[model samples]
Structures are given as structure tokens and as C-alpha cells.
Target: MALDHSLVGVASDPVERTWRAGDVIVYALGVGAGAADPTEELAFTTENTAGVELRVLPTFAVLAAQARTGRRLGDFDPARLVHAEQAFELHAPLPVDGRVQVVSTVTGIADKGSGALVSTENTATDAETGKLLVTSRSGVFIRGEGGFGRSGPASDDWRLPERAPDEQVRYRTRPEQALLYRLSGDRNPLHSDPAFAARGGFDRPILHGLCTYGFTGRALLHALCSSDSGGSDPDRFDAMSGRFTKPVLPGQELVVSIWGDGDGAALFRTATDDGTVVIDRGRVRFH
Candidate 1:
């Protein structure tokens, strides 16, 4: 099937969602927020466990905008869509809980000989105040589908530093990690049912890409935005982008290398302890 190139540049109707502090905590836990140390990360996993309002992880913007992904893209079979890359630019820190309005657009689509890449951008604003909160961009790789007759738009291409990583953060994923992550609105059986995973040509369930995205962000927050560790502030985190290179099996150890850009932000690359690069060409830009 070919994508409808005509749909490019079209914006979808806004989707309004009401999220609460409890919802934020669930998403935080789904991504392993407090696993490093519950007390140290209580601000993320609890509303006021530390007497401060919880801070939403930047990656949750993807989840908040997911409902609108179906609007702009034309009738491509859901079976063929595969997530390729994702990015989020935060204009302001996400409130602990509030009404959010999400409007998405099909920024572009690229035709490949065998398949097509569909790119989308979703912008979210605070519903009550009309303040822009986040703008998220993502690309989907459709297999066995192409011939859309368009080359899409130019994507952002930035350079990482040429030196060694400045720091590394390590974390271990639980065997039931995927199970917990799926509760965060991604209920695909491929992530929960072993029989379904085997049928799909995997030995067991795989971790959600967004789950890994959150984990990567959590690692960054710890290494660069925490007190007494990297001597960084959470408010400094402004944006993050990454390309998924490999699937992560639950129960594997993830080690992420943090390279500072000499700016407030940094570049990141994550891999399993076995040296398999799971997230590549990753970057986080903060002010």
C-alpha cells in the first residue's frame, strides 16, 4: 500500500486530555523512575512524598499525544507501521497535573523503493492557560509499502562531540519490565504474551520503545539533573531525541554514556551490558 502524499502538511483536530498527579506517577513507574532509589526519586513517583510537587518525565509527552497519531496519516494498515525515531522539545516543564490539548500534523512522508517513512509532529499546549508545553516529532517506517511519490522533508541532523563520553549511568531492567510498561497505554500482546511474541518471531516479549525512551531520560536526569550526583538541576532538561536501533529484552542491563556539548545539554547513547547499541544518535538539549 502507498501512503497518500496529499496528507502531508495536514493538521489534525486537537485532542484534549485531563491528566492528574496519579497518572503521572503511573507513567513514571512504568518507565522505572524510582528503581534506582525510591527515596532519591520520590519527587517523580509520588505527589508529595518529599513535600514537593511531582515532576513529569519529559518522555510522557509522547504518551499524552499518542491519541492524535491516528488522525493525520491516511489509511495505512496498522500492521505495517513501525516506529523509527522520536523527539520531544519542551518549552516549559510539564505541570504536575493539568488539562492538556494536543494537535498533530503530518509533517512529511518519504517514498522508499520497498517501503515508506511517515513523519509526524504533535504539539501540546496547556488547556487552561493556552501555553505551549511540548512539541513532539516522530517517524514511522512502514514495511513492504512505498511508492508514495514524495521525498519527505529534511530531518534534523546534529553532531555529537568527538571525544570520549564524560560519564556513564547503569541500571538493570526487571524481568517483568515490559509487563509493567505495557500498563502505560501500550497494551500490545506482543509485549505481554509469550505465545504471541513467539508467533511474531521472538523468543519472548520485548520492551516498549517508549519505555526505553523513558529509561534513557531517567538515566539522563540522574546523571545530569540530580543533586549530589552530577550536580545538575532537573529544570535544565529541555529536549531529547533518539533513534531506536535494536529491541531490548527485559532483564538486561542498560548503560548509557553521557557526553556534554559544553552547553547545558548533552548527547547520549545507550546499550546493553553486552555492547549491543539499543539507542543510537541520541541527543538531549537543555537550557
Candidate 2:
């Protein structure tokens, strides 16, 4: 069946979620924290390391806000769904352990000929203090489920600058990267199970798009938001958004290029060593 356009604008009931310091550490490692050297990102990879205190990555907001919507878009093969875009804004730096009440809404369903783009927005608030915490927006493209004849939402006016990027950082993914990242609650077979991946037109399992996002987020966090002491400061990171243009296999290296866009923001993109852009139209706002 095709997607249910009626689902648009429907809001889900509040779902509460809680995360511990351990969860944060696992997520950090999932995204390649300290993979190069355990001692480098001690703040994120370990909760206790002498004078260094543990800190949560800004991208952790995406994982923290993932609560069951208790609603389905429509009937279709799960493999047909692909993460198309993702963005999140942090109202405040996330704590190592905290409880949150999350409300999600199907904000839009646009027709894109071959498939439909279903967009969602999630708002998470501190359960005890009732203060806003994170707002995340994401879109998924469902192949073979479009042509409903409805025009989708307008695209953002984003264009790359003509000048060279101010900075570029590269990180290599381990061959077992997907295996580790899946532990962070996204158990989709697309990132594992070779047979399942083959069915989705992949030679082998591909890394999760969000995993790539997390990797890119790590590059941005350090390049633009690091503390005076050279530690990653989540407080200095405000928001980020990006579009996934290609899949990344495990063990491939990722190069993140950032251009200062002025006004405490920057435009960035992630590519492989061969210069194939995988994540494009990226933007990040920081202190």
C-alpha cells in the first residue's frame, strides 16, 4: 500500500526515555570515539580518567530523542526506507544520565516520483524539570512508494561557497564499525546481515547513515566547538543538519570539510578519500 498522507500533522503520544552514562559512552564509541587512540577522546569514551570528566557528544541528542512513535506510516518493505536527511538543535548540553519525555509528529509527506519522503520532528524535554532539551528533524525516503502526485515541501536555499573550506578532518572507520554502531539501538539489518543487505541491492552490509552523521558530527564538534582546554564541549555546539547522498561501507575513511559561514555557523560536507561526497548540504551552528 502507498503511504498514508493523512498521517501528516499527526502527533504521537509522549514517550519517556532515560539514558545513563554507560549509554553515552557506548554511543561515543559507536561513532568512532577514541578509535584511533583510547587516550585522545578520554572525555567521551570513559566516564572516569583522572582529571578528565566524561562528556556527551552533541549528536547524542539524536539517539536520546528516539522514542517509539507508536504509529506506522504504511505497509511496505522495511528495506525500502532510507534515511534522507537529518538535523537536530540542542536547547542545552545533554547530561550524562537523564530522563526525557519525547513527543514526535509526522510533519510532512511529499511525493518524489519514485518514492515518498516522510519527514518527522521530535521534541524532547527534561522529564523532571520540564525544560526543553532537544529538537530533532529527520526525513526518510521510501523507494517504490511514491508518485502519489503531491508536490513535496520546499527545499532549503543552500549552496556551497566558492572558496576553499577552512578546515578538513579525516577519520577511518573500522571494519567492525557497523557491528558496534548497531548496539546504539538501531538494529536495522541494512547495516548488518549480508543476506538482508543483498536484498536491498548492496553487495554487503553498509554502514548506517546516522553512523556517518555521527562521525561527521564528531568532526564538527572538535573543529568548531572544542573547549579552551582542547576538550570537546557540548555546550559550544548548538545545531547541525545534513543530507545523505551516498552509502558508506565499513572501514572506509571519511573526510569532513568545513567552511565558516559567518554568524557562528558553518557549511560542511563529508566525502570519501576519492572525493565522492556522501553527506552534503551540511550546516552547523556553534558558539
Candidate 3:
């Protein structure tokens, strides 16, 4: 079946979100924010003598609203929906306590005969200050949803250079990684309960999808951004995108390899400690 050209560039409903201090902390914990130490720098749950407001975790960009008002995934076969790729760009630092709004729009639609690629963009802005915070670009491949002849302009695939990686960064997860990441309000039991994981063909709880995204961002920041600059400057980094392959367990360490191909574009991969590639074929565009 061909994609339905009528559905190309179709925009979805806008999603609005407001975050509080507690919400910020929980999101951090879900990603193993304080797992390294009870007194880690990113820990927000600890009793504080300074009584400062909680700092927002950069990964919170994933939870921003999308236009789902008139759309329901169940309308299409559930198995047809697959996350293809995701990328995010940050413009300003986000605060823990603030009102935010997300406006998502369809950016691309490609028909791949048996499957369809639907690309969406989520733009987040601070409601109070009216500051543009972040923009998240995502694509989902729906296996059975194509054949309506829907496809827009041809998009370019990110190119990876043929060379060895210059730097590799790794992060280890605790057995309760999913438990911690779920505090961000993505309580999919597949990452927590053993029975649920078994039902999903997993040996144990898995990490949140966004946790992996966070790890990728952390790796990119380490590889591209000036670590000495504390990751606040977006000019140092260009862009990043990747697909999630195998689910990562909480206790696993993700080794990410990044290489500079000049012109600020780089390539990266996240693998397991045993050298199994978890996120294969990643590309980063740097400034």
C-alpha cells in the first residue's frame, strides 16, 4: 500500500504542560539523577539548608505536549506504531517551577510501501516568561498505516563519516533505573514490574525511552559541548538524532563513541559494556 498524500504534513493537536518543583525532581530521579550518590549535584530531593528552588532537568523536553486532540494511536493498529528517530535543540535553560506550552506539528511524512514515516515537531515555550525553551523533533514509523500515498519532500539521511571514533563516554545505570525514570510521569510498567517485563519478553525492568535519550544527550554534550563551559551554550553543538534499538537494563553501562567529521558534524553510537550496540547508527550535527 502507498501512503495517503492527503495526510502529509497534517498537524496534530497542541499539548500544554505546566511543571512544578516536585515534578522536576521526580523526572531527575527517574533518570538515575541521584543514583551516583545521595548527595550528587543533580539531586533535588535532599533536605536543603539553602532552600533554593529545584533545577529543571534538561531531559524534561521529552514530556512536552503534542497535538493529540483529534488523533488516537488506537485508530491505527497498535503494532504499526514505531518510534523512528528523535532530535532536540535547546534555546534557553528551563526552570523547575514554571508554566510551559508545547506546540507539535507534522513536519514530514514518508511512505515506505509497507510502512509510513510520520515526523512531528514539538516546540516548548515558557508560559510565564514567554521564552522559547526547547524544540524536539521526532519521527514514528507506522507499519500498516502507509499506502494512502502520503509523502512530502524527500528528506536527507544523516551521513556518518568513515573513520574511527575519537572519544567514547559511558554511563552506568542502577538496577532501579526504570523505577527512577518513571517519576517523570511515564510509568510504563514494562520498565518496572518483573511480571510486566516478562509479558513484554524482557528478562527484567527496562529503562525509560527518554532515559536513553538523556544518556545520548549527555554523551553528545561531553563529546561536543565545552564541558568546562557547563553545557549552557548551544552554539558549541549543532544537532543530534538516533533510533533506539534494544532496551537497556538499569544495571547496564552504556558506552557511547563519538567522532568529529569536521564542520561540527559528528557520529555517535551507544553500546553495552560487552560491546553490543544498543543505539546503532547515530549522527550528530555540530556547530
Candidate 4:
């Protein structure tokens, strides 16, 4: 199961994806949006009645408009696939209604003695106008797919901040959060069907990693800045990168721990109630 370095830079089949109004709203709620005030910008369920033109939530790019033709992990093996890291870049906010096309490619494949890392990049564009909406980069570790003839470098070990965090925020997820989040477009059954999860090594349906990302954003909003306009801009969180260490079940309490790294840098980590660290070796940079 080791990484096939030959697969590096292999561009997968382009997939076309589209989004509807309802899909946008459901995605917003899945990530704990509108939980604090019910009047927040992400309260898509009610904000539709607001005066402004509604735009699809940016994170929805991960799910919506994806070209379904890419090579999936099933082409390899499910039990060996481990989501190692992920990141996103927003070129522009997507219009609520539109068809989009995404081009996904396997950018890098590295083999270590113990495991392999596969990196993929996805670029989404408006199908009609060809406007670039977002680009995503993801890396996954295939646990048993290593020890090939080649001796690639191992995954780097991260060093967390030594100082105690200056702030911590806790957020609660809805019972059906995964179901709601999946509506955004990621229909990975692992997050929906208990049978699939148990087979994948979980007890029950698990939350989407991006859902965890959204919840972390909410916690960051609380820990780093005020919800008021004078405090910070909602769009400030333009980029986020993190490593996924564990699965997050629905209704779990995520306690986001943050430490100021001085000179504009900050560190973060998210853990569940049972002391499970869902996100680790995390860092956030702001404008």
C-alpha cells in the first residue's frame, strides 16, 4: 500500500459540481453557525429573509461544484487511508446559484518507511464565467502503504508551544450536525452511516473535518476577537491549515485552546470532552 511516487502530479478527471440555495444554508448550520446569536451572518436558515444578497458560504466550495471524476481512496484501500492535513484558499466568494467545475490533481506522493503521504490539489471555478472561486490542498497518510523500495523522508513531528494558552473557548455541536454538514456536498458515508463508520474503525457516524474547521473558526472568533464589527471582520479567516488526529462524533464538546505566539503569530488546538485531540499541530495567521 505504499505511495506510488509515479502518481505524483497525476491530474485526475475533472469533475463538475453545482449548488442550490438550500445546500448553502444547511452547510452553514452544520458548523455551529448562528449558535451564539441566531442573528450571525452564517445563520443562513433565517438570513435569507435579510435584505442583502445571499452568497454561498465560502467553505461550501469544499463540497459543492466538485468534479466527481477524481480517483477516490477506494481505488486503494479504505482502512489504510488517514487524513493527515488540509488547507484552503479563497479567490472570491461564490454566487449562491451557479454550476462550477473543479480540477483535482495528485500533486505529490511521498513514501516513508512506516507510511506514505499523498497530496492533492483541487481548483474550483465557475462553470459559466470560468471565475475561480477557491483552491484546496489536502494531504493524507496511508498507514499500511509504505516501506516501498524507496526511502522517502518521514512525516515531520510538530512542536507545540511550551507556554500555557491565554484563551480557550468551547463549542457544542448539534446532534445531527454531520447530516446537516453533509448536505453541503461531502456525501462521504463515513460521516452519515454508522455501519460505514464502524467498518472504518469508529463507533458511530463522525463529524466532517471541515465541520470541525468551522467550529474552530467559531471558537477563534470568540477567543481572538469580538463578534462585533469593530472587533474583527468575518472574512479575516481567509486561510486555515491543520492536521487531523482523531474523529469527532456529533454532539461532542470541542474545546479550542489558543496561545499567542507574539509578533502576530498564534497557535491553536481542538480537543473533545473525553480528552480526544481532534485537531493538533495547528497555527493560524491573520491579516
Query: Could you estimate the TM-score for every candidate?
Result: 0.89, 0.98, 0.76, 0.81
| Cα lDDT of model 1 by residue, 235-272, tens digit | 77888999888889998888899998776778899999
Instruction: Give the least accurate 10-residue stretch of model 2, judged by summed lDDT.
Output: 1-10
| Highest TM-score model number | 2
Candidate 2 per-residue lDDT, tens place, 1-287, comes to 55777888978899999999999999999999998888889999998789989899999999888998778899998888889999999998899998999999999888898888899999999999999999999999999988778877678899989989899999999999999999999999999999988877899999999999999999999898867777778889999999999999999999999999988999999999989899999999999
**Which ten contiguous residues of candidate 3 have the minimum total lDDT?**
40-49
Between prediction 3 and prediction 4, the one with superior TM-score is 4
Reference-based lDDT, residue 181, model 1? 88
Question: For each candidate, what is the lDDT?
Answer: 0.79, 0.92, 0.66, 0.71
Task: Name the runs in model 4 displaced over 4 angstroms.
Answer: 1-6, 41-43, 51-58, 70-74, 112-115, 128-131, 149-158, 221-232, 261-265
| Candidate 3 lDDT tens digits, 1-287 | 23334543566554667777777667666665555555543434442436433455455656653334554333554333545677776676666566677776767677777777877788888877778877888877767666657565654675555777799877788777777777667666767778876765567777766787776765676467653535333345545677776778788898888877667777788888998777766877655
Model 1 vs. true fold: TM: 0.89
List ranges where model 1 is wrong by over 4 Å: 69-79, 153-162, 195-200, 227-232
Rank candidates by TM-score, best first.
2, 1, 4, 3
Q: Rank the models by lDDT, top first.
A: 2, 1, 4, 3
Off by over 4 Å in 2: none
